[model samples]
Target: MPAEPLATVVGLLRDKFDLALPETSTELWHGHPVWLDDDLPVAGFKAYPTFVTVLFWRGQAITDHSGKLNASGSAEMSEYKLKSVDDFDSDLFDVWLQQVRELEAA
Candidate 1:
């Protein structure tokens, strides 16, 4: 489980994420919080001792001109690290969220 502060951050981000994609539902996959669009995994969040990791399943396909999302291990995945609630970039995140929804719909 995450610490109190981290849990709060998780809650805040989760709420915003859910609001962005109102069609998505929350689920637990491998004990981490995952957001699914019509049963397809679209995004997920995992908390760590020092940071929280947010991932987009098809993030590599996103055209993130802001350069916020990091190129992670897989060729199809992209991620962002948030150390605190303040680090949560709502504008950039919303852009990515909309892109993911569009990609999934396509």
Candidate 2:
């Protein structure tokens, strides 16, 4: 069953990032919800029996973003599981989103 928060978050993504979301069902990579972009892997979200995980692609692209991610509450999170909706931080996520946009443009 899809959680309300998941749909809400997906909406948040489409509204904010304009990422033409991949046809994501329950999938995993690095052991988490694999939200794909353009048939290639981009971002991911993990859904435990109880919660959802949000994983960002281009992690290497943000090598210097640890402080921002941590301060904003997106730090050192499970590279495998997300247990709360709060785990999805749009602020830090927006940066990765921008990277995706730039990559698409280029």
Candidate 3:
């Protein structure tokens, strides 16, 4: 993938995450930016060759009526893949973030 598009998507995601997850700590874990709630992985994003994947650690437990999140990895993990900026949905993302926070707290 080209750097420009990737950068734009990453910038948007980072800014949104920063604003929505103010109470969480963000760090580069395994070379990917991840938000942690007291050392527990809450959410994160990883850039792949064809797309960017936004992940919720306990997403399987989240109530996503939109059906955008796809089960990923093990445990309760889920992911939404974006091929470009156009694929990003702010409203859905916001809702997911809120659910992720609540799940983390629980």
Candidate 4:
């Protein structure tokens, strides 16, 4: 994807994350933006050549009724790939973010 559209997607995701996870610290881990709860990664986003992948460290545990999150790797991680800003659903992301924070807390 083009840089402009990708930047827009990144901006949208980052904005929502900042709003939803005010208590978590934000940082660039392995070159990607990650939100950490007490130094443990709870959620993050990686920009790829084709899309931006939003990831939840304990995503498999989240009750994602929307079913947009796909299992990533062989762990509790889950992800949603966005090719554009329109692919992002703020409401769904907020729900998932809340669940992920809860998982991290536990």
Candidate 5:
């Protein structure tokens, strides 16, 4: 982990982090990188054999679902994933940021 694992994940989250509050931070949760706001996690990430897990918290908060949040490939996570760097889409990242905002607000 030349850069930290969370750092790597946050680098990915960087695509969606701006819209959320500054209180949001990253940590290791069950050996995964997790993002938190006011102590409540907004998202988490993990890299498996063939994919990655991008777990969005406040998962219970999203009421009006629109936009893209994918959990494809073999990460097998219950939340969304981007699997590869090529999958990082700004529009979808914006959606994830929106979810982060909603979570922080709660």
Candidate 6:
């Protein structure tokens, strides 16, 4: 489990995403929490000194209609930086999660 507020955020994310992708598995990857599709990493979260970052491994391919992803000029990855759980947007996150699953399936 994560520490304090992070745990709350993680719980919310897990609950929401698990319902959408029942087969997804979560584990610590390089000390960061990650949701996996079989052996492939679909999404992950890392707690930084400045903020918590949620990562989409193949996010570059997914169209963010909400324009929430922080591009940071990365090619195959994108991330959302949140200072707290209140910054987490469930609807937008779901759209990204669904798109990633479809991309992985393809």
User: Over the full model, what C-alpha lDDT does candidate 2 score relative to the true structure?
Assistant: 0.49
- The TM-scores of all predictions, comma-separated, are 0.89, 0.46, 0.93, 0.92, 0.63, 0.81
lDDT, candidates in the order shown:
0.87, 0.49, 0.88, 0.88, 0.59, 0.79
Candidate 4 lDDT:
0.88
Q: Write the per-residue lDDT of candidate 4 for residues 14-102, one digit (tens) a residue.
A: 89999988899999998889999889888999998779999998889999898889999998999999988789888888889888767
Winning model by TM-score: 3
lDDT tens per residue, model 3, 1-106: 3376877898999999999899999999889999999998899999987789998889898888999899998788999999989988889889988888777767
| Poorest lDDT segment (10 consecutive residues) of candidate 4 | 1-10
Candidate 4 local lDDT, residue 7: 88
RMSD of each candidate relative to the true structure: 1.5, 6.5, 1.5, 1.6, 5.4, 2.2
Q: Residues 19-91, candidate 5: write the lDDT tens digits.
A: 4545677778888667787676667767665566666655544543643454433543236655556666666
Q: What is model 2's C-alpha RMSD?
A: 6.5
Q: Sort by lDDT, best first.
A: 3, 4, 1, 6, 5, 2
Q: Show model 1 residue runs off by greater than 4 Å.
A: none
Candidate 6 ranges beyond 4 A from true positions: 1-4, 72-75
Better of 4 and 5 by lDDT: 4
For each predicted model, how many residue pairs clash, with residues at least 3 apart or on different chains?
0, 2, 0, 0, 2, 0
Query: Weakest 10 consecutive residues, lDDT, candidate 1?
Result: 66-75
Show model 4 residue runs off by greater than 4 Å.
Answer: none
Using TM-score as the measure, what is the rank order of every candidate, best first? 3, 4, 1, 6, 5, 2
In model 5, residue pairs whose N, Cα or C atoms come closer than 3 Å (at least 3 residues apart or on different chains), thus clashing, are 70-81, 71-81
List, residue by residue over 1-106, the lDDT tens digit for candidate 2: 3477666655554454334442333355566455555555555554546654444555444444544322123543223233445656766566656665555445
Candidate 1's TM-score reads 0.89
Model 5 scores a TM of 0.63
